[model samples]
Target: MNEYPIEYYQFFIKFNEGDYYTCHDLLEDMWMEDKSNLFLKGLLQMSVAIYHYSYGNVKGTRLMMKVAHEYLQPYRPKQWGLDLESVIAYIEHCISIIPDDIDKVSFSKIEELPALPTLFLYLEDD
Candidate 1:
């Protein structure tokens, strides 16, 4: 199957092409289909994080990045060559430049990554 929705890549292309709102709209559709889909949710959070970062809301951006990290933790996107580490790494890199006086500067760094493990672990119980 295709790795992501047509709209997903379209959003990135639009984002790179400088259409922020369009990106949000695309992700909103995926969000509506399944509120808890980790992939969609994580990407949505990523879009928001980068947007906020660009707008200079360092705190808000960091919060969104943290949420994105939490959302991806369960799946370990690296296994599939997804760019989860780079996402979090970029956010953290930005946060590092923020003065320590910032109130939400609490989360630690992401030092390693590996893709989600096989679900076979649970299947053996059957």
Candidate 2:
């Protein structure tokens, strides 16, 4: 088997540990410098978009998601359909979360979610 660079593991660590932005940033470097892994590249872009969406960065989310879609367009999503759809929903939800009268106060009024929103997703995202 072939090995990828340390940067890949670094990105994975950050992603698994929930340092969303950091993982996203590291993945960008790998995506740009490594030409041998198109699938990995697409996955990383999707991860970045999801990370950005997790932080309410709508534009960043859309940009990366679009890139991911383009890259993966040649393949059949059936293999990773659920994960792919999940990411797409996450990106869209971030955009939808905004409303003309989105009161942060509304969120505050709500009790804690059943699960704390996941900050970092690992191999799945990266």
Candidate 3:
């Protein structure tokens, strides 16, 4: 098994705490160090997408979710204790609910959207 860095775990902590912005910050440096690391890039994009959704920016949320999905698709099943398949499914679900005509949706209406379920990262042994 490959050992992951501290930031990798910290990203999950922030994510589960509903601190999506912090999740992005936790992984940004690692992603920067290895631009080819699709996992890290995908995680960063995922954090950004959730952050945008929290702020009721439907357009930004949809855009970021699409990019995150693209980066994460190749890692289906699992990677470094993360379940890419489940994550991708969740992203697709979020994308499906976002309206294509983004401009017409008010922030109040966006707030009414269902709250995303908490994401959990399981240990490899589990």
Query: Model 1: per-residue lDDT, tens digit, 20-126?
Result: 56767898897898887776677677677656545455577667767876787776535233555565565456555543344333223211211111111000111
Name the 10 consecutive residues with the lowest summed lDDT in model 2.
Answer: 98-107
Q: Model 3, range 23-79, lDDT digits (tens) per residue? A: 898889898888899988988998998888776777788888899999998887788
Structure candidate 3, residue pairs in collision:
none
The best candidate in terms of lDDT = 3
The TM-scores of all predictions, comma-separated, are: 0.63, 0.50, 0.87
| Model 1 lowest lDDT segment of ten | 117-126
lDDT of each: 0.57, 0.54, 0.81
Cα misplacement distance, residue 31 of candidate 2 (Å): 2.3
lDDT of 2 at 78: 25
Model 2, 1-126: lDDT tens per residue?
335578776765776676766866776677677666555566677677655545445466556666766665554342222244544454455435433242222335434212223434333322
